[model samples]
Target: MTDSQDHFDVLIVGAGMSGIDAAYHLSRTLPDMRFAMLDSKDSFGGTWHTHRFPGIRSDSDLYTFGFEWKPWTGVPIATADEILRYLDEALDENDLRRHIRFGQTVRAARWNSGTNLWTVTVERGVETVTLTCRFLWMCSGYYRHTQGYQPDWPGMGDFTGQIVHPQHWPQDLDHTGKRVVVIGSGATAATLIPAMAETAAHVTMLQRSPTYYYPRPKRDELATTLQALDIPQDWVHEIMRRKFLQDGKTMVRRSREEPQAVAAELIGAAQAYLGPDYDVATHFTPSYRPWRQRVAMVPDGDLFVAIRSGQASVVTDTIKRITATGIELDSGQVLEADIIVTATGLTLSALGDVAFQVDGAPVDLTQSWTHRGVMLTGLPNLAMVFGYLRTSWTMRADLVSDYVCRLLAHMQDRGAASVTPALRDTDRDMPVRPWIDPENFNAGYILRALDVMPRQGDRQPWLMTQDYFDDRITLPAANLEDGTLVYR
Candidate 1:
């Protein structure tokens, strides 16, 4: 046990994209504030460092995905190595590495009202350590890192060939000259199929349902043109950022208002890449509106190229059982494969699965409401960064970081030791809804964890719009004295 007097002013969990962003904001906004960061992983680049699967890359454009303070000079779509390098550069340039303690997994955080601080317990290797902080910032991402979601098939153990999950890909596994079957049509599956097809004898993507996919250029022509004109890097970054934000807004609106037309355009693009006679509708046309699930980006149409070249194929059928050689489909067909890659989906873990208690009482996240999409209701001096689904995650992450810094500044000015978003009497009467509407953002992982996640009310800070443009103006500029936020 350590004395509470030695605690940091702020303690940040997870040294990945969100944590690094928070640290950058803190450094710029409050250089005098004492803060430290802890990450379960041994290094930075959270997801980028963890998943070393083939063809791993960003599903969103780098201009939007990259930090607002930094200019991304690479191509629009970046590979895992490129992203890891970028993160390394960011940490070095900002000197954030000095404040990070690696291999520290936070297990529980208990808030003490008497001391106005949070006591966090973390496990580092074989030792247990406890620390305290005035504020707790959770940057740990939404999904579980130890394992991805793998459904129980009738006979998964019957498979004789090697089976792998993208989350835990074997470094020495060989795919060359082998038949591979990838299960799922999400981002991971979409990325793996094309990358594996180049070396595998034949690759098949077996999905129960189709997913919306958009072909994005590997390079950005507008950015290239601007740079060719000798435009400043900062100016180009801003221009591209705004352009992508507006384009994302328009795309989401169009997807909702004119789903059929948007669906046709997406399918038509696939036809262009796969040849005029290819049956794109059977494998690419999603039943739901675009953006309901993330629209997987196929960089430079690589997946379609592989499919057109006869190296890869798509089978839309449910698996009835797993055989020794491959999977048996409900349609009375079996796809034989030498290797099986289950890219099913991710399992959402709220706040890194850290158990939270306030004043010795357990905090049920499901009953709490979200405040401005950053903090949970009734949680004092805490903020969690959960990014937008429609746009690049960093867009919201950067904004949330800026907002949290502003909040801390306000608290300091008021000499307040604690601040919590509490529901007002007026808000209590409002309808409580799921944090997000499943119909609007029905990604499988989100739907799976909806029951355990936080809720949202109908009005103001209690509701999360998931719109960057709307949040950009409201979150940073809103009055801190709003009735919902209680400062003490």
Candidate 2:
């Protein structure tokens, strides 16, 4: 434990997108800082590495999804392989590979106020190791990688066909010429249906309710045009990222300001893709307004194309039970299939479900309040790297990494050992709200984890929001001596 290998200036958990970005910023802004990036997987790319589902791709465009400092030269919506390659290059180009340890999973982190250090227990293969760090950066993603969420249906065990979850797709289970039924209507289902339809005999999307879908070409015209003109990748990345952000901002604003109009436009887009005679209302139109949960992307209108070709179809009905052969709907209709893929959703895991302690007491994040959505109240030298729910997650990750570096430098300037967020006496009466506003964005994973997440206050720095535009302004100009953050 006394060896230099056991100690670091900072320990960044999860060597995925955010972890690599944090390491890059630390190397550039805090060059002398000794840091390490750790991940449970055998390699980088958290979700991408774990999800081997066919035709797996990003829901958001890669322009903004890529690191702010790095440029993405691939299609707007990139595949899992493309993203993994990009992450690999980010590590190699920034010399961040040396700072990363693969197959190292953090088990628990205990904070010591006396020495202002955190002793972390890690599971590395067959060995248990202990490491100490002055600061802990949580870059691990929000969902559980080992298991995906699937509802227990009345007869799931009775189904004769192969039931599979997209999170753990089997390598040997080929869907070629198979009668496949994908349960769910989110991004994963949208992606799987189209890909499976290409080879499967026929694919049917069974959904309890419809989700809003936005259509866009696979390749971005502007990025392609600029690339064709021999423009530099960095400039293309900057311009495209800004362009996408502005357009997304306008759309988000319109959804809030003019919900009905936005909803109609979204529904109409589906009508245009599927033919005028097609019934968009029964299967494509959602009862809620646009962006209520998430408007999944239908890249190249593939989902509709599959529908048009009769290779795929949608069934809007509640499942009465999963019979031995297929699913029985509430309408007394049963769907028969050779394979059933459950693209239900993901399960949220706080701090990768790692146990934590502070000052010899078990740390319960549900009792803590988020300080600007990064640092938690009463947690010294620990900050999380959560991202935007509506926008590309990397957009917020970049901003947070910058702010963390700035805060670290500020603490160094004052010769302080630790900084923690604490509510002032005047803040005692502030009402607490859910971690995320359900009215704005209510993703199932976030809602399910509400009881386990930190509370938000009614005022500044305490009222954590998903508004990226407001955050872009306030996070950089955040006040250090605002009395909300206590330094020791």
Candidate 3:
């Protein structure tokens, strides 16, 4: 990559799904606008490209997870390789690869009101390059790609075998016929247990507490039925997307309104897979309500099948420490292992932890309020793609892409150089809250990063409502003439 300073109408940070969607929208909607996409990694597919654990797959169904514009003909649940292939195809079909500047990390962005441009400093290897853009799009995502979150347990150095975090998986790792102990109950752990059980001597999934596992078929019945009828791929995609969205909205609403009923259905499903003999209450039932944390999807009940086959087992107990041989349980049980896989959650950063300045003053993101969970209050000409937690992530990405394009077109028509979200007289006394409400959803990763993320105001435009059903209707219908978004 060259070190020369360049200017663009829009600068998109990150070449992942969000960035690619934004770029695609920009290309389609504003064909004459100059734009560039950057990713710290050498290639696209942010999480898909980076996470290389065994049987790494989408926790959410691909119909909702896949981009709305692109038709996904693959199974509902897809592997990382499959997703990468899909993403790669999207890039190639749209001629998007040429617009991406890989291996460049956005270091800092300074917004100057005088010039109405963002002077972005990016680094590639040892060379620092400067670029400016009229509008900055933060599609970098929230997850820290550099490392996964691994808790520091005592005697970790004493362990004789390889201890790997799923995020930074070793390419040459061979766990065949080896005793593996995976320390997690989330999606990664669920995916790995069955995958490793195929070759490993045995795999034990150790969790401090249980997470709800929702077993679903790999293929969507509707999609398969439509394909059998020889319906067009685009029509099938839209039909499935709408069906899933409506179903998901109803489920989420029910999860909120009838927590116990939703929880019972999930537990009953697990019991059906594990059989009546298995301790479903101890290992399958979550203490919290459904959707409090993302329910891990087990395609075809693979994990339960592995457990039922006696090739794999689940141990719900607190870890005391790591010994030379295996993990020591607080219950005085010692499980030996040849390999320990930390299927721990992600290390997140709000807006990729990049330094931002507004006309020279450093922006304090934690102090600012999120505007529709897409743009930030007091941040001019900037929007970050923070996707849905309960639903498939790509759904929110697609919506935000359309919203951004619409916003840009509105600004152009109004001859506006910059737009910022400012609190009006009506919003002066509005109460503030955390990025995510703990009562509604309290995942460990989100709780850990509360102080590092932006706050949310109590009202409509100021709140970062994670509801996709509401956002889909509200985002596009948002009035540009509204007093909240100040145009200059």
TM-score of each: 0.98, 0.98, 0.98
Question: Which regions of candidate 2 are displaced past 4 Å?
Answer: none
Model 1 off-target regions past 4 Å?
Answer: 1-6
lDDT of 2 at 326: 88
Indicate whether candidate 1 or candidate 2 has the larger lDDT.
2
Model 3, which residues run further than 4 Å from truth?
1-5
Candidate 1 lDDT over residue span 265-314, tens digit each: 98888889999888877898888888889998998889989999999999
Considering only N, C-alpha and C atoms within 3 Å, which residue pairs clash in candidate 3? none
Q: By how many angstroms RMSD does model 2 differ from the true structure? A: 1.0
Candidate 2, which ten residues in sequence have the lowest lDDT sum?
440-449
Ten contiguous residues with the weakest lDDT in model 1: 1-10
Could you give me the TM-score of model 1 versus the true structure?
Answer: 0.98
Writing each residue's lDDT as its tens digit, candidate 2 over 265-352 gives: 9899899989999989899878887877888998999999999999999999998999998899999999998899999999988878
RMSD of each: 1.2, 1.0, 1.6
